[model samples]
Target: MLAPVLRKIIQNKTVMIERYLPSKGNLFVQKGDILEPFQKLGDCMHSPNTVYFPKEFEPVKFLREKVYFQKGSLIGKIGAKKVTADENGYMSFDEVSGEYFYEDMPVKFTLLSGLWGEVSDVIPESSVLIKTVVAEVDLVACTPNFSFGELVVFPNPTEILEKFYLESFVKSTEGKIVYVGHYADLDTIKKARDLKISAIVAGSADPVGFSFAKSANIGLGVVSGFGKLETPDFVYKLFNSVAYRHVFFHGDLGVLRIPMSGVEEETVSSKKKKTPLKVIKKVTKGQKVQVLQKPHFGKIGTIDRVSVSSIFVRFDNELGPVEIDLPNFFIIE
Candidate 1:
């Protein structure tokens, strides 16, 4: 029983995005191929590449810092006998590609080249890409003090960001998310001064609604498309922010931007959940007891439960659990 319940909870939920430090941004260069003549760098800052972010980029995760970038794809490995750039206002990179070292590296490029160039693109104003994991544990084989490996669910990632704060899970918890679901008012934004949740998931921030998970320093994601708003596009934007490299899709469906570790699933054996308490002693195996003003002139009823001093019983015609006071209490059957 517990196996199925736990499986359902884990299966139905998708983190979609995880938070990271604010992107320092990334390095990018124009001139097409790496060997393009350095003079062709007519303000390489004008060119932009498609950057894919991780699935957890929004909603679940935040950028802790602003992003930084380099001019060329080569990361600091240019060889010894190379010509360095000192006048183009570009920086030098000692980067090794394939086999040889390339020296000159550009300094900065437009952070939003693709965003600005593709007039038709409906880039997300904000979003996040998250990674997910399915953890398995043998309920029967483990005790309260036992290890479930990596089964501990992550905290409400939104709580870790500066713009967003965490809330209590039990106060009016909708489910497992501790600090989500209901949110405080934007006027209370100052109240978030001490919160630890990440940025808000964009667009969903309606302080007036029941589902409004208020966003603060934490990230909040929203939907955006070429001309409309769509959930998938909103998610994709997060991936681009992840991969300033614009290289491979982390996922098969042209979805990359995330570097995931320990993403594999595990198998485990489990057992059913038993009732908290069982019948300890009974006067008869099947004969349930009843208290009456007179032994034979009473009504028949069903035993709902028992306590130290009384038994809460129910009858076929009754509306609710009825208490029967008794000097001593125990299961009759």
Candidate 2:
């Protein structure tokens, strides 16, 4: 029998990434220049003009529909306390809803290299292209988004620990890519969005939570298919080793990329050429595989025997040898 091959990780793969600004901005790196993860790449002034409606804001009666105010100017009162403009902005009252909103001015956004690499190309006033070697982890499913941030790996959470594990890292999670646990529920996804987490990596996710992530524009990558599943042992160990490193999550490509160190890159460059990666392979006895169905979902086992349409797998757990349909398992490469 033939089966699909799931490559959990590819080490020392060369890749190019483009770091750009939303608008035209200054470029701080040139071709062939070495870049560090914390180095500033460029900056741009852009107006997000975010609208805000303060809770309990009660506008003064007979106030103009729209008014401009300096910082600290009184807008209204919240209960017995006065509510003032937080910044120089325009406040407009919504006649239909009886609410008010403030819009602020342009702000500066600085771009960081976010990786250890060399500048391969530059797009003047816009972006810099970098060439780097990295270790890549495959994701079975992910939202359509792109994010780069410091990777934070947490221990796999038990049912009880999952509820409170994220709370412990509340202060440090903002703008970071976090590995929550083996399974993420809807509440976990909602909490991550509220905490401003850049992305979430999990072994499996609740289908509803996955849908919410897409709608909320949050990055979510799953190593295993949906529903409660354990993270593959190899993937967990790899993440633990790279914790705190700058990483890239390409949800559209279904991969998490961790840049390799300069020494590691040089070592890979000196090694003999490797053969092409195989995506399909013939099923045989003693092959490692992962079950994709219930009863043994996400479990890794060794094939004991292969038939025309089924394979008997030997798991370390007491389940002993079990026969799994060919389509219910995939070779783990």
Candidate 3:
């Protein structure tokens, strides 16, 4: 019988990533240029403190292009009401567009390559596309968001230890993607959000906490099924080995991507000559499977025997082989 195969982890897959700025910015790399993870790609002046005024508003003679103004400084009027600058910035009037705008001091933002790759394409003053090889981990459930940062893997924590674990890294957690252990509770989710963490990955999460993450727009990815399930041993070990590596959390695609090294890319290129990995296969004895139902949800076991519509699986910790319906488990390839 043919069964669906779930790929928990895939290694050395080539992908293209586009890194862009919020506004028009400089591009430093050209096509075919090789880049390292720490390489600087470009920089931009980002201004989020801009305000617009009605076209009908009249401005003082002193309100000229590039004229600096401080908070509460009056520079114009809309009929009898006087308009003041809300923050310190330069003033400008666009005659062609008939628009008045106040912009605060722009913040300088530097862009990093973030991966080992070759520049595949570049859009001037906007974005750069890099072709790179990476390792991908499938997530069963995830919030619909996108985030990229250094991956932080914590030791599996008990309920009481969760807070302490978070506090230990409080200063370094901001803008990072962290693995919060076997299951994430509501308190853990709240603490992460407060710390300004970019996103969180867990083995499983409380449905309530998962809902909160979605509503709050925090990126959350679950590797295993929900409700108090342990992270599969293999997945946990893989994450532990790659702590502090640059990673991408694509919640919409339900995958975590970790860029691979140049040597790994070479190995992948060599393997391209071989047959590709399979995503579906015939059920057989001795195959590894992950249970999707209660009693053994998220547990991995080896198939001992295959029946007409069920398979008998043997768990290392269980006393005897357990019969599982075909639909309740999937082959882990």
Highest TM-score model number: 2
Question: What is every candidate's alpha-carbon RMSD to the true fold?
Answer: 22.4, 5.0, 5.3
Q: Give all TM-scores, in the order shown.
A: 0.19, 0.79, 0.77
Error of 1 at 245 (Å): 23
Full candidate order by lDDT, most accurate first: 3, 2, 1
- Candidate 2, residue 261: CA error in Å? 2.5
| TM-score (C-alpha) between model 2 and the true structure | 0.79
Each prediction's whole-model lDDT (CA): 0.26, 0.84, 0.86
> In lDDT terms, which candidate is top?
3
Model 2, 1-333: lDDT tens digits are 899988777765469999998778887878999998889999998655646556587766546466777888887787899877778877887776666777665589899988888999999999999998787888999999999899999899886786577888899999899998899888999999999999999999988999999999999999977888777787898799889998999998999988887776555422222347667899999988999866888888899998889999998884668989979999876
| Alpha carbon deviation, residue 244, candidate 1 (Å) | 23
| lDDT for residue 274 in candidate 3, whole number 0-100 | 25
Q: What's the true lDDT of residue 60 in model 1?
A: 17
